[model samples]
Target: MSKVLQFACHFFAVCVSSNTPTAVYLGIMKHNGVPVDADLMKSRQQEAEQQMQRIRNEIIMLIGDVEIGANCGTKAFEDYLYQTLKLPVMKVTASNKEAADDASMIMLKEWCDANRPELSSLFTLVQECRKWSKIKSTYIDGYLKYLNSATGRIHPDFFALSTETGRMNCKTPKAQNLPRKSNDPIRVRNFIKAPEDHLILSLDFSQIELRVGAFYCRDRTMMETYKNGGDIHAATTSVIFSCTYEEAQDKHRKEYKEQRTIVKNVNFGTFYGLFPKGLQSTLKFKAGVEKSVDECEAIIRNLKSGYSALTTWQEETKRDAAGKMYIETWLGRRRYLSNIRSENWGLKSFAERCALNTPIQVTAADILKLAIVRILEGLPSRPWLKPILQIHDELTFIIPKEKLNEAVIFIRECMEQQPFPEFDLPLVAEASAGESFGNLEELEG
Candidate 1:
């Protein structure tokens, strides 16, 4: 065989052998499809449609009978925002036309909040209309279309090796992409109903990615924060804002709340070698906190200074990837970055960012997969615990209502076990339970 073909075969063999346990676990989850409350789903669909119509009418009244499509993606709507309403365009498609995507809407809303308070109501109506339309069509109608006639549940297919980072991808109804309670105004997750004598329990790894990043970077501040069970975001806020930890933890004060929110976003983005412009845009568009590029640079500088090991690790990682043309997770799963040596600045920079991101993210993915294998091994003793879904770092299951305490302890133990011998920091899995997926309340030990 050609060298390339031989390498490909070896790679596939390694991946298949390493991931067999996770594949088996996912098969079991697929067999036990997620239960749905058909009646509740139908009601939600009707309510969402009504809300969409009301918002559409309100938008039409404001914008003077413009034809607004269900998703507000029409050219006329774009023209209204840029031409008639005169909102500044924040982003554009690859074709270079004025953008009206969700990010654009968020930026336009922020602009209205600052510059045109009188017109803020128009964007609010547009955003709400789009949200209701998505919830209705994507969640309600989408789920109904895929509902199995015989089983009465939506059986989403999971692909274990599809993603480059080793995370499983869900399709058909895309159950993994369901909006969380904070974002789901209509509570679409409530459609994931447990049986009368059962409850939906979720055990989510608490900030698994950050913990993995800390392990990779060996940053003293980050490792110490996790070790002490302190709030990493608050520690980051203290570092960036130059305030006492107590001051940063003061959420009641408006200034501190805004600062902490910005700091949290910065901390999440920093691991991927976030540029100042990117950080500024992320804070404004995603976090709703307007920050100048210079301010963002200062925050990043503070972060690097406070966590000195992070920059050292990032530099060393990039240098190694450039030299070897590949990066690997801590568990030795390799991702080849052919463009690391490219002459083009864009490709080289992207490869560098991937080099920094893949190790930490893929390592976290490995840890989650290991936890799944552990759960699978213990499943025979606890057949009442039916694993239904794996969403990122969280595992959702159905258990008898009477078995809540026992199941929580079992699942938490599975998820919290040391992923590998070298992973010195502690791993935490938080438990929550409820009658429906949307209404879960955190279970205290």
Candidate 2:
């Protein structure tokens, strides 16, 4: 290729490959429109649509031979469906009235209910079909149809200030909202691949929210547990049940495992300011632990008593929000609490919880963004590396296979660098590498 043609091709390749915002690139280059590699984009779109159709057919087959009114359409069908799916009849009845045409994750999960273990495969198939169908239709097909016909690529517009938290939002293709890694047949991520001799390396923070929570509260037990590189959930379970980690895993292992799960839920929910009723429903449906509101209250009490500093911090944060009507992250990112002092109990409670949770979550978001910027800054120095995508806490890069070792170290170091030292806790990032985005394996440090 001629020098000018080669540079143009290289620039286009980088724009597509580096997760560069299309509008930003176009504006910088003074280009009126963006180009897409139509042939390549079309081939991938077709493959995804074909796979989605296959799954759709299988879903139909799995439902098998049920009469419309007998097993599908009528009230009798609803009853039979609940019985077969093992969903709580009352909940199904209620939600059916709520969203008779809906098939959301929460709804499907409710339908899966107590028989999760036995019906997990069925549930996976059902959900995968639904999720993949939407992705194929809304993203792949939509992107193909909407691609800049002249340029042959989709240039999704990204709005940095769209979210309540400081997270970037993408429209057109909604690139940020794509499905996560799943074991099911829907491999939408597979379409995202590295160029020849390059691999996609994903590095994600491990248990960042919990770590941030511990650091914020300065809860001695939590800090000690995290600092020692111990299992925080198991540690909390031990505290709640008065047993060692070993004992929790050894004697009555299954029961202790369930206990650990309860602790895990409490750990997550405490940050969200979940009430006993919320805990009770989550425990009953998600954890498969049938607990009454009173039992859930006891668990909440145990969590609070065990992590007194964290509980106190939560209450203090809420009080501060009620008074000042705002909360800020460690790095000075402010989330104004407009409804924190509302007279309506529900609105006030929601605002209070958001105030408590936003700081920790936004801190994590800030860290991730800083890490991305740092990674970008470091990339030019390493010629073989190009960052292709970032989803949530994970950053995906395209790097030569030979540079994997150095790349892993560099990425994790960038990711784990703490911008604010006073709020110190060891930040851990897990990594993986693969030629395709869908099949990354753990990169053990």
Candidate 3:
């Protein structure tokens, strides 16, 4: 116990100076609590339950008396998908069992669309049923369970040191996990509402990680894209598909639309030493775009060639990490990669990827924290401004309706400030305002 206490004291001494401001701000934010619309949440819960029941009945009619569990994760459902329906197993669990998870279902649905058109509806219904179930059980019921009866709000606990990359984590309702507008069919974000005359304002850093990656790699094409205010994704699309930048940016062309999406995903992952197989899986499962491994290889090859410095940086980073057994952000937050020198291919490969990812991601996280500290410093003069939530790359607050302009300007100034003296690229934070969390409109400059 004495030895453990000594180690803990040393750890605290090292981190306390850097983390104190964030800790203080998070404590105050938790105490403030997020205002909830109890009546609206309850109504949404009821509507979601009804939708779940309808979907459940439809699933039952499709698969007669299969005895699939509530989440469709039962052995019975596995048999129904693989043995009964004869759908090929696109993915498997860690134990090598046939997987019935959402990704698997999506892959199966795509297969059905191509080969067995009749079975596609079954997978569609299953996907809808699962989505509704998640909203009810995870978001609605989970949030209600923690709602404070006295305050009529939910107070989530935030941990600053929980993640390895120094990103914040929220729990006791997981406020940070709230779905975006595209994914939230039930408008779960609407549950968090501003008090009578107050409005919700959000400031999000635009493409921050990509910007950081360009700074680190010094990739001329990437740096030039941001420096000139060009669309990075569209620029990448041009490189990947061998088209003119205008053709890649053309909204009317279907091929450009699909290829641009693939390029966007690739750009986000490429800096992290994304491999061909991993790219293939990411495209298929996450983006729902089917790409063969060879095709994914070609896309990556083109990306590396276009952004020539990227491959150079990746190789140099991996070599340095392997030698030192650690990597660090620009702010000097170190993440040790013990497996960087491991003999096993998988372990060593994962460590190498972490070596590439930690610097870009952790630097971005540090910039956000710096903004939080600035907001905390400025909050005393503006007592009406209330900091509520910090999602990835975004900070949300509740402010007086009349103070919308004031709050937006102050918050944007704090967020757009240079995080460190060495960070050369201009940082941008887009602001939005609305009465509810779901319906925010971008505030033009």
Indicate which candidate wins on TM-score: 3
**Tens digit of per-residue lDDT, candidate 1, span 29-108:** 88999999988889888898888888888888888877788978899989988998777878888899899988788778
TM-score of each: 0.92, 0.73, 0.93
Worst 10 residues of 3 by lDDT: 9-18
Which ranking of candidates, highest TM-score first? 3, 1, 2
Q: For model 3, how does the per-residue alpha-carbon lDDT over 170-257 read when each residue is reduced to its tens digit?
A: 9998999987566789899899899999999999999999999999999988888888988999889988889999998899997976
Instruction: Supply the global lDDT for candidate 2.
Output: 0.68
Candidate 1 residue 128 Cα shift, in angstroms, is 1.5
Provide the lowest-lDDT 10-residue window in model 2: 25-34
Q: Per-residue lDDT for 133 in model 3?
A: 83
What residue pairs are clashing in model 3? none
By lDDT, the best candidate is 3
